[model samples]
Target: MSTVGAQSRGVLRAACRQVGLPDEGAQPIRIAGNAIWRLPGGIVARIGRPDGREIAERELAVARWLTDSGVRTVRPAIADGPVLVDGRPVTFWDELAPHRPGTAADVARLLKQMHQLTPPASLTLPPLEPLTKPTRRIAEAGLLTTDDRRWLQDHVGQLAADFAGLPAGLPAGLPLCALHGDAWDGNVAVDADGTAYLLDLENTCYGPPEWDLVSTAVKHLTTATVTAAAYEDFCSTYGMDVTSWPGYPVLAGIRELRMVTFALQIADEHPHARAEAQHRVDCLRGRKGPRPWTWTAVP
Candidate 1:
């Protein structure tokens, strides 16, 4: 199920009753690591909002495509070409049972497997939502302290790329895959039993496997061994293309910047999150690499 508002949730509850999936009420569940009250028995009946209609269509389509490719996902419902609840758009899904793991190795590998799955050629999706604009917003809004801006700025020159040698177009007939644009840790969920379910496909799009990988690297549990081993296991399972690393690594900085930008927009919603976002910018600034780890929207 997706996120929903108060009245929208009521409208969906009615729809569920009409469809024979009568719900008692929403039992509070932590979906996508966010507190959402999904209908007792229906996932779609729980979400409310029209702003996500276009995105919902894409995410549901990609979810089906990925399911066919052997990835475990929340199945989107089919309800007479999208349902309306008090003017808000709502989608349904079967409640997924997942297990959360304490370490990054397990989570990273799971994400890697999903990354390796190939999507149908006809599946044309959206563009990569880079981190540059978001970060710029944060800067302009006075969301960051002077120190943090300086930190992100220091990374600017270092991450610049040479576009001269870039390929004119993607390979003539290489397989493309369904990509989770905002494949951050918050989108992952683990049930008490230890199974994982990737969530929040609103940012789903069509792109390289790295679109998922670059963000997956920022783990709750940090360890180089876990990072390397998890990726190694994924490579062994999927035989990914590593020559793409140099490129994805640089792109991840953009992700960092994007994250900073998002924080500014939502910082008011949660105090701890705002503090942590600012702290994260500090962390990125301290970590030195061949390229700047701050956001860049060049592509």
Candidate 2:
């Protein structure tokens, strides 16, 4: 096991002990960024990094808010605790039963529903800060050469400016509301009966609906991760095609940059991610030319 994996398991064990849940037979769900384990009794425990307590608390609150608003999301298993275990924050969720990744249309409909609701006055969601994580990752990436790091930072600065000064912000008729922040087919799960539920509320925030739509647009337009037909279905269901909007290139650029930096952030801890991280950086540096770059999905 990688160092991160071992450390996460230790934290997971400590957390499970605190919650009176058994650590035996706990299956790892994912081990990057956050360590997720499917525990016994239909519970999913997500163990975040040491400094992630605030974010974990926010995630719990966001889940509660979404559920209260009648949005079908992964509900919090324990309402009061983002239990701190050995400094790592752990949050428990009610695991879904036999679900597959949601289709693009499912993502669209769910996002549309989320974007329309007014967050209750008590829920104080932070405004979207698109460049925060990517910029930090780029600066901290040990694998990048000096030149590569400089170039990526410069590119991030330019995109940040473009996003702030967007000529026609927020699209035509949409008002800002709580966005799924990382909206995409992958972040949604569809159950056996085809009911879709949103997952990963850590990034949920008050933001432009366009920010939420841009991920789907990039999946089709830039990375081609989703099929053209699926992209069409998403737009038809959501009532807007984000790629057609004038401000799209800027948001798409930001999204792609985030993907690249995210890969870099994990490359050191998980060596298997290094080559794909390099590939993504190369694509951005114009080695691979333009849009529709063949970017692989990394866990």
TM-score of every prediction relative to native: 0.65, 0.97
Per-model CA lDDT versus the true structure: 0.54, 0.89
Q: Give the Å shift of residue 232 in candidate 1.
A: 4.4
Segments in model 1 whose C-alpha atoms lie over 4 Å from true places: 1-24, 30-35, 42-50, 78-88, 101-122, 132-142, 145-176, 184-196, 220-235, 240-244, 285-299
lDDT of 1: 0.54
* Tens digits of per-residue lDDT for model 1, 46-121: 3534454666666677778777777766777663434555554556777665445324444455666666666677
Highest-scoring model, lDDT: 2
How many clashes show up per model? 11, 0
